[model samples]
Target: MTISTTSTIAADAADAMPPLYGLKVLDFTRVLAGPFCTAMLADAGAEVIKVEPFEGDDYRQMGLQVDGHSANFAFVNRGKRSVRLNLKQAGARDVIARLAGWADVVIENFKPGVADRLGIGYGALSALNPGLVYCSISGFGQSGPWAEQPAYDTVIQALSGLMDVTGDPAGAPTLVGESVADVAAGMFASWGVMAALWQRERTGRGRYLDVAMYDCLLSMMPTLVSRVMAGAPATRQGNRHANSAPFGAFHAADGLFVLAVANNRLFAKLAEVLGQPALASAPEFATNQDRKRQEAALARLIEDWASALPVQEAVRRLTEAGVPAAPVLSVAATVASDNAQARGLVVRQRPASGPAMCHVEQPVRFDAMPRGQTSAAPALGADTLAVLEALGFDAGAVNAMQQQGVI
Candidate 1:
């Protein structure tokens, strides 16, 4: 089956130019980390050609589906084209080599040595295209004692000491709600790729990036890591801040709210907001360090006042008193909030063959360039023929390859 190239550029030509408008990315990523990295590039206007296996990305079948397309897949794979190639076949290497030659950057999250075994490792691709900024995302990086050990987000979270400091002090270790390790690795990989691209412009050469989920998660916990390194045992504070007093979730009349009394000033304001201004001057709460010593007492005092008021009212009173406070909003409430709408946080994109879908826009913004339009994640092999044609393959050749099950 042949697919048209009409959906290649989702954003209109008249829209503001994207930062990576002329950039070309060859994406051999499957799941969250690699796809998310490429998604950022694609959102910035890079032409990302996602090379998938013949059966498609495993993520496409792993989550809630809209018209048979996975919503999770859509969230991370938007604004990119999909080209399916059976890399196990002998004929597939040529296609990958051609794409590598055409690309400015290539990203993959294959297990260590898998790409090399397939003859498409950074060494091979950089040889074919000397200026390629290749990024390899993995569980434990290219060389490590645990490099060969298989890992998922939870595994990294466990090993990175993130889970150790996540839950209530008396509770079992808790996994964060989202895939923090995977997302962090993806974010860091994008940073590495961008830095490499910038460096390449000056040095006239490419570089390889080794981004590990474990390392990225470990890097994310600077405070916790430093504390542990300094001989402090890891402590789980749950919703409480490690070094701050009365800085955590508190129950209100209607629901939960969070307030941060980061300094003495904020604590004083919080005390005033709770209608007990004298508490700010109390010997136990006079200073942040003293308040930290009596955090349970402070929390009780604050909660006593907060529990009488609804979350919004408590938040408003705290705000008026110059204290930082906000209600705890669920995901649904957050997405529908006025702030979310005003900031264009949610976007709509239509896939080539499916109904329109909503996505969260990339967070970064450029003053000179308006946000680009969104595109739905492509169907498997949606751009196989088009990508092959772009690689100088004729329709007859593509047909022959298809007949041979190479794509």
Candidate 2:
């Protein structure tokens, strides 16, 4: 399901119709990375039971509230059940143990060894349910030199050389605009979970996944790693790439547009489109390597030429000349773009107590042959009673569990 996972997977529900339907996943993750990964499984139709703590996921309090839940929380947790449980309490462990027995997968994002301390670590639970695809996500891996240190997205970025390669030539090194490290790790974890689940069907065994944000970030550092390995100088180019010249943003009369004259052919096309065909074969700009040697002069020429043309016309000319160009669009612009609307990216969701929610639809669309009705995110504790009953907890046990600070 991911771009990187190298495994043979069967065409399960996740790959066919509602991909994750009929599969029960216990999600013990919070914040960006873990939630984002499980959210992917949920979007594909997994019955994700988001097991929250007694105090609830911290993101529930972030952003604008929608019917007692934050929009931030609702966006990622839009199709999962929430059951509150206090894991520190003895009563809660029994409930979690029961859920583990019932669940097909378990995802957690607590700090290193926190789950072990709580007795829900893979070693303990795998003994109870060998078929569970247990996954743990953290800033660092469960074991290593820096496993126990506190980490945030920025810390990982700084430590992994991502930040060092992500800024303007002379600008301060910037963290990625979004939590890319967390997102990458979550995505990787999700891929691992699905692979493990599919493998379990054939092997009748589950796998434990250990995805660390720092390691994920490091894995994504292609250009930076290459340069470091080769001992090449890495400049701080805010919007430019060290791999190629004329591959950055430029301002047109109307707005900003990005262009990537990546190779010699595109560079020639760019020069001719700009009515400077003579520059196409000029000694200082003939080859990509030569252009990089004279990047300052080349950039100045592009800026001067781009300044006189309107954004749309400039983009049109470049496009017509076999070059890539596009306006830098904001969220509003993207939502309103003709291409996005045509692709059916804007989906409508109507929660009973609130206004209709217009959110982005699932990015993974089947081949128009999948079947089944979609499921929305569950209300807080909406399925608690049903889940308890299914677990063979009679009425009295349910009541007793609730009274003992467990759901």
Candidate 3:
């Protein structure tokens, strides 16, 4: 089972040197939030070891499959190694302890008390390696009234009042199409890890991180919450901005488009683009306050003009007129658009066992360089033996652990 270090593939010289190169992360996480956090670190060139149960991460079977691997899993797991271990097995504790000693960071998303019961909690591991940055992502943080209550994205969104301000004004509350809360928590957790690492460099000490989906989502509700704090009622305005006029979707001859005529200058440009330049000088629509009061009438006039033109023509005319506008696009259309390709926003990779796959590239750049090429997600336990050997385990020991179902 042991793999010789000499046989390990060396990194390509042509690839850009990643910012997190040589950082080692032990990822004791699965599903969305924790996986996403570690994935970002891995994308930055950390050597992330994803430790999973023998049956593999549940996300592996939750979404669309490509050659028997989940596309969802692939999206968040690329650029990492996988090591299978049954933490319930007595022998697995030793394996986890060893990996803990080697890792600079350990991130887990287990519900409260689970990690402690499994003996891989912060206290146990931090005792073994005090400089190890341990991050725990949970539904409601490590200590709270709802800490033990299970939660998913929708639940967090609803509880955080995000749903209350989403969707059409007259419609039932709607959950965001994507898992915003989970992704936010993941992003915050990654930021926390980096901050902790930076501080450790100065003080020679590691810290524990408690990231909560509820807290993250609530933090993102400043606009709505702040309004309420100022004694304003919270209400949904559909696609419209609460304080802006003509700042939402409109229909064209062929499809839907959006505009953001936030300032008088932009509103004037929009009026000129609509062939009603005099409307800009009209007292009823001359100022932002005036437009806000007559938004419905103004939107109707713009829509009447746009409804005569195709979405593309409408968008082109608006752009040329110096007004910000865009046609609403489907997910497929977005990925295929020239703008996406020009920005290098999508990446294509061919896995050893699956068809070529396309993924959204990390939306970050360093030194004017986009993220480096990423490897395909690993198959379950694909690098167990190699990782163990890299950890100094010999062939016989690896074989014994495997036979005992500890890895």
Quick one: best TM-score, which candidate? Answer: 1
Q: Score residue 282 of candidate 1 by CA lDDT.
A: 88
lDDT of 1 by residue, 1-407 (tens): 12233323444544556777778888999889999988888878788889998789999898788777788998899888889888889888888888888899999999999999988899999999999999999999999899999989999999988887889898999999999999999999999999999999999999999999999999989898898899987799988988888899998899999989888888777777777888878888877788889989888888898778989999999888788889999999999999998988888777768767777756998665665375678889888887898788998888888898999
The estimated TM-scores of all candidates read 0.95, 0.90, 0.95
List candidate 1 stretches off by more than 4 Å: 1-15
RMSD, one per candidate, in order: 2.5, 4.8, 2.6
Off by over 4 Å in 2: 1-16, 64-68, 354-362, 369-376
Q: If both were scored by lDDT, which would come out higher, candidate 2 or candidate 3?
A: 3
lDDT of prediction 1: 0.86
The global Cα lDDT (0 to 1) of model 2 is: 0.78
Candidate 3 global lDDT: 0.86
Candidate 1 or 2, higher lDDT?
1
Model 2, span 136-217: residue lDDT tens: 9999999999999988888998888778878775777887887788888988898899889889999999999999999888
Note the Cα lDDT for every prediction shown.
0.86, 0.78, 0.86
Candidate 3 lDDT by residue in tens digits, 300-370 = 99889988899999999999888999999999898889998888887777776776766664578766334
**Total backbone clashes of model 3?**
0
